[model samples]
Target: MLTLTEKPRRSPKNEQLNSCASSFADYEDCIVGFMDDLQLVHCGHDKKCLGCGEELAHLTLRGVLRGSVGVIGESRLAMTEKVVLLGGRVCAVKRFRQVSSGRREFGKKIEHLARVSQKCEYLVPVAAYLYAKRIKQHGHTALDWNQRLTIIVQIARGIGFIHEQYPPYEKKMQMNVHGNIKVCNVMVNTDFSACLSGYGFTQLAEPVEVLNTGQLMKSPCRQQENTTYSDELSQKSDIYNFGVILLDILAGPKGLEMTKGVKEKKASMKLEGGLEFFEFYVKEGKERRQVSKVLEIALACISTKPDARPSIEEICFNIVEIL
Candidate 1:
């Protein structure tokens, strides 16, 4: 199992060590101390490692990760995020919000995901799980076109594997659904591949009754029920969320906001205006046509009727073909 070394001794002349520090400050101090103890230098402000100017950003933990002893990075999620030292390697930790019950079940699910991640390159590699009262936030931004496409395809393959129940071994597990599929939940590894997060959190939400036809039924009393049901945690709902991610990729941050407005307007007008939105952003030529094709796929995925959407396998196939 992964273990941490003892904390590095502080310098006798450095008087700043006596001041009170926040948990995040303490974590940073620990990292700086460890680096100093090992006689390492900073590659830049974000990373430090042994040897002159060697990049340590790509490092991954080698063994089973232990919880909460030697944390190096921290970020907020549904609850909190942390990076910990394990066997001289670094790994990320995600801590969920505390609830009244089902802590055991939550841990089991995370353990299962960690095992699954070892076998699939697409899912985020989880090393350890932890429970805590509070933690700090970390920021991650989206990638460019080529990088985004690569990650999107990888995510599609990961979701496809879950839906197919195809584990690495011969034994088949139950078909799984990635109820959350959004840009925020997609993490970029050191190599720039996509790793999906927040898989099991969907279970924490209230369950919706599904129709026998595998479609989400609307509640009788609410007028906005259709919109609400369309956004529920389900296989089809995942596809819709993925479609939004696609739009985010095709359109940059600013363009995505415009497309969202177009989408809402299209919903109100009850028109299948289709790929015309691409014309505003994409040049009218081969590039536009290619984008239009991708937009078509995205449109189908986000169809108002869940039954109208393609299966995860089909979506993967289409994305692969596009790539």
Candidate 2:
């Protein structure tokens, strides 16, 4: 088995060599050549094992489970369902293809995710991740009340893990931002535990120019370009996205759409009787109060002022208290 470790930074000459490599075989040659020169640790073989040449090669493509669904969203990547044989077990894969650029950066993002996931179980475990002409993928596979409370708390813990960045994992700074967070990005395992997947892909992808739209939007606080808090991807922004996820959970699928329409209106205090629209759904007693508390936390998360939003730790605490 190939041991996965961080790749050494390429020298300018190596970069040029890599840029000139025309095919996957040529690129592998470049890497092998570099590794041989430095006597860098590698699978003990004169001819590098092509199967495990890349850091994530252990999860090799076993068979195509499904076909491509053309380019999707800002990632500008195609998706395919496939089956990968890893550790003698079959795992479902979500293969990705980047359009023109950012492949290297995306690979680093995956490396960072893989490292973090090793330490944080709340993150979606990467069975394998690789980058080439286009990125490829591999990996494996939640909800209710006491179930509702359990779901949100687990979600918060996952987000908090991303935010905290403790110890060895902190060596690589890029792992800090979960640039994309949404209902679709949050996956529930068969065991009902929530794990976050889509992380740095949004940042690597082509940036969308339009403001305040879509499932993942720029936090209102960072809308202005010149502000110190202008980075669209930040801990606070993750919190804001988490808030949206909470709202989506509270409201069903159709209700989530309605909530989005009302979001702008709600921010401006223009929604007729305020949050009563959401409150109307729950019974008027303790259930309404409990739901209202959760809503308040959600609203705080999506606050226009990033400073006003609670940290992930605080969000977790509040949710735990409510439960």
Q: What does candidate 1's lDDT look like per residue over 204-317, in tens digits? A: 333334332201111111111222223465778888877766665665333344655655665432233234453233444544445555666776777778899999888877
Error of 1 at 156 (Å): 1.3
Score candidate 1 by TM-score against the native. Answer: 0.55
Locate the minimum summed-lDDT window of 10 residues in model 1: 214-223
Per-residue lDDT tens digits for candidate 2, residues 30-147, read 2443432222222222323322434333322111212121212222222222233323333323333332235454455555555566576666655422221110011110133344
Positional deviation of residue 74's Cα in model 2 after best superposition, in angstroms: 10
TM of each candidate vs. truth: 0.55, 0.55
Q: What is the lDDT of residue 76 in candidate 2?
A: 22
- Please, what is the whole-model Cα lDDT of each candidate in the order they appear? 0.47, 0.48
How much lDDT does candidate 1 score?
0.47
How good is model 2 by TM-score?
0.55
State residue 119's C-alpha deviation in candidate 2, in Å: 1.4
